[model samples]
Target: MVDADQTFVIVGGGLAGAKAAETLRAEGFTGRVILICDERDHPYERPPLSKGYLLGKEERESVFVHEPAWYAAHDIELHLGQTVDAIDRSAKTVRFGDDGTAVRYDKLLLATGAEPRRLDIPGTDLAGVHHLRRLAHAERLKHVLTNLGRDNGHLVIAGAGWIGLEVAAAAREYGAEVTVVHSGPTPLHSVLGPELGQLFAELHREHGVRFHFGARLTEITGQDGMVLAARTDDGEEHPAHDVLAAIGAAPRTHLAEAAGLEIADPAHGGGIVVDERLRTSDPDIHAAGDVVSFPHALFDTRLRVEHWANALNGGPAAARAMLGHDVTYDRVPYFFSDQYDLGMEYSGWAPPGSYDQVVIRGDAGKREFVAFWVKENRVLAGMNVNVWNVTDTIQRLIRGRARVNTEHLADPHIPLEDLAP
Candidate 1:
């Protein structure tokens, strides 16, 4: 039980921070909690920003996790638009901006999250090029799409990941000419592997979105206050009116590092270093969400997973640990992406270059399939396209370490439930 006056300072008011504060209250912690967010608005859903928000299918108010009044009702001090400039670990206080007002905390949760990586090419500062990460970024892009008109407008996306593809689908729906430039051979190769990556390449091509596979971008050129063309290393030039660089995101670790907190290397390519209980090097501080780098039980190595489910799960896990109920944060990792009338879902952990066999269930040609990644007679991971229901069963089998027969796995006649342990 926490003392009624114990102050819990939570940095970053995104999904992880918001969820952690809510979980603290649910866990019977009647403490003075302060949530500091650089953004003025309340926490909003980011997933919709790339799809529905871009299409204007969702409103800003609708995307907010909770209304401003809800924070007051929960006795949470919502400090919006205030950036924490530095941390004084010796004094256990956080100093923000020129205001010099210091916030002291008995416990601190760093959910600082990450920001979208920007293209370091020429003309990147042009008015037409954008990167979507926050609600503001999405709103700006939405305004551009509405005012500029997508009909006959050329949209060039610099990365072929989920965000890039989703934005492409939305832009294409608006009758815009879309082109995806990927340095890799295909789309989502790092996550979905080569076979499914090629399938996505075909799917996007069928939708009138041109793809430049294995093409490296050298520079983004602009003229007369607008983006003109993107130059590639292979001497291929793509004319563009608007450009979006969706390369990826790097962990926001400046604050943590400035506070003298130890950070994990990007060798695992994730974020902050954390233990099973989500505790960072500084025992008083805990981290979760995309900013955390922790060891994976399934992969027997450290991994940094960026997914909505991870933020939701990890936030509460850190809260429990802070409340003195330490539990191992071990669960099958899961992620989902909705693109062009198709649902893509993945579960479990797959080590790089370790899979020896793959079992294809259902028909890939029909765009409905589940691919099982197998190694040493054990299922490592599963990717389901347009088949969400099978994810739960697959996750269960993977968690139980079930050895499924390849013959039955490849047959569409066999139900997934029968293979469950």
Candidate 2:
């Protein structure tokens, strides 16, 4: 167990790091708490970057997890705009690159998060090209969209993932002509399945966004250091005043690797490997958020979730474990997304081809529905789209792992509570 005088250091200032700091204080640990983040701003949430904040529906202040004064009030030391260049495991210190300041820690928690993947195509370094992972990126993209106008604005998006789709929606709302080119057969097909992915594709098309599925982006053509067009594998080119490469993000694991921590193999999704308690190979250190790939106690599979809920919940769980608590971080994975009129909440582990069938309730065509993926008569995962007030029940069905009547599950009249075991 950690003593009161020991210094507890947290790396990464997103939702996970902030929550870990809050947990350390709430758990009555009076240790010296210090949070180190590379970003200049205080801890903030990332979802709104592509949704409300991008659409100008939310103010900049609301994006922060907590105001700047909260850290001071909570007696936490803040190290903003600093990069941890190396972890001196033998010396038990972290070295910062900028000022060469080394901070000692009795216990360390890593919530390094993930970084947006960049395309290697030509003209990627040109102006008017963006990726929506950081606050600064969103700010610049919003400014470009606001000034670009509808008449000649063409936004080319590479990747049909959630970020790509959400940005497409926001661009359309701003009256920009948008085009998405993805290698997948449909948007979000790998996760939501083709049926539901097609629904989202149709949604975007109806809103005046063009999608080219099974297409490869050959290059991003530009002139005078400004984006002009993007060419595809078929030699077809689309107008592109701006481009968003939302291919996906990779977990930040260089620090862990330098410290000789266990990292999962590329064949196994390639992330920092940890146990159920979110403890890395070194017991003195712990990792959470998108950076750590920990074994799932319920499913017997390792998972590295990049969703907001995981960071919000996993950070606290790791904090508890750092304080010498035997923690089994076994919460079913959950995530949600907002695009256009669709709001979706999904829970449980839905591995590829794991479910035998997907049962639906409500009207999918109307975009108000609940879909449950079932394997061996048990609910593996469930997603509620454009529907409100039933996330708790959906989580219960997944956690309980009980067989339910398909007819009852498919009936809107039959309450979800009645379907529970």
Candidate 3:
């Protein structure tokens, strides 16, 4: 049992940090817990920021991780608007805020999340340019989108990744003219590859969204500190009132790096390296969530997942490890996305060149199908689009590692459970 004198400090007021604090208490740890957040608001999930909240389908209160009273009732020392600038490893303390209040910890958990990658082009400092990563940015974007809808303004979004496509759908729903600029031929090319990425391209085109393929945003021209237009490398200029840089995010590892913790190389996705138990270079210092690069036994690789489910499960796993429990953080990677009427849940990892064949079950034309990435007759990963109640069976196939008949895998009539066994 942890003594009452022991203190556990978790940096970064995000879903992972908040959930870690909750797990400590649930597991009967009576040690002092200090959760510090840079933002003034409490910890909350980030998915809704780009999806429902941005679309106005969800309310402001729904985005929060817990009720305001839950933290105090549970005796969690919640510090908001205080950023940890440095970590004194030898002294075992962290100093923060304007006053430089120092807090000592027996164990330190780094859950500092990622920051959005900004466009390096000109006119990025313009008033009408926007990027969505935090609640505050979403709140400002919500107002910008609302005004654009009411005034019949056009919005040009850079990058055709998940964030870009989701925001495109939301903007279209709000009656704003939407155009996406991407260097790839289709959306989500880095994740879904060209085969499935083309499906999303068609989906958006049907919704009246324009796509500028094989080019990137070179410049954003503006007048009087407001956006006027976006110029592409292909020499095409798109007229716009507002611009959303829906580019991807980079992991926030400066604090971890400054503390002399070993960081993963760019090929490994650039994060703080952690073992299967989520232990960093310093045994007392652990890292989890998006900031961590953990070794996955199943995939035989070190993966740094920036998905919602990773944070939801990684936090509790790290908490248990901190309590000296036998923990192996080997949960299958899972993530879901909602665009228009389509909903998808992707399980396992299947990057390009990692899989040999992609078999489809059900009707792709109708937007209801299960696509499997197979390598040498074994299922590496599977994605269910507009198809429900098969994630369990799909994960079973991945974990089971049994050879599946390629013919049966593509047959909609054959049940997924039967093939795994």
Q: Best candidate, lDDT-wise?
A: 3
State the lDDT of candidate 2 residue by residue for 1-421, as single tens digits. Answer: 5677899999999999999999999998998998999999889999999999999999999999998999999999999998898888888898874879998999899999999988988888889789989999999989877865556589999999989999999998898889999999999887888767888999999999999889888899899999999999988899999999999889999999989999998666678899988989998899999898989866778888888999999999999998887789988888888988889998887756878888999999999999998888899888999888898998889888888988889999999988875
Q: Which stretches of candidate 1 lie over 4 Å from their true place?
A: 147-149
The candidate that achieves the highest TM-score relative to the unseen native structure:
3
lDDT of 3 by residue, 159-196 (tens): 99888888888888888889999998789887787889
Which lDDT values do the candidates have, in the order given? 0.85, 0.90, 0.92
lDDT of 2: 0.90
Residue 70 C-alpha lDDT in model 1: 85
Worst 10 residues of 3 by lDDT: 412-421
Clashing pairs in 2: none
What is the TM-score of candidate 1?
0.97
Output the TM-score of candidate 2.
Answer: 0.98
Each prediction's TM-score against the native? 0.97, 0.98, 0.98
True-structure Cα RMSD, model 2: 1.2
Candidate 1 local lDDT, 1-421, one digit each (tens): 6788788889988888999988988898998989998898897767888877788887778877778798889999999998999888888898874587798998899999899998887888888999998998998888766654535888889999888999888887777888899999889877767867888888888889999988867888988878988888899999988999999999999999888787887766857888889988888899998898887786787778777888888888998899899579886889888778878888987744768877789889988999888887678899898976788898887887867788888888888888888
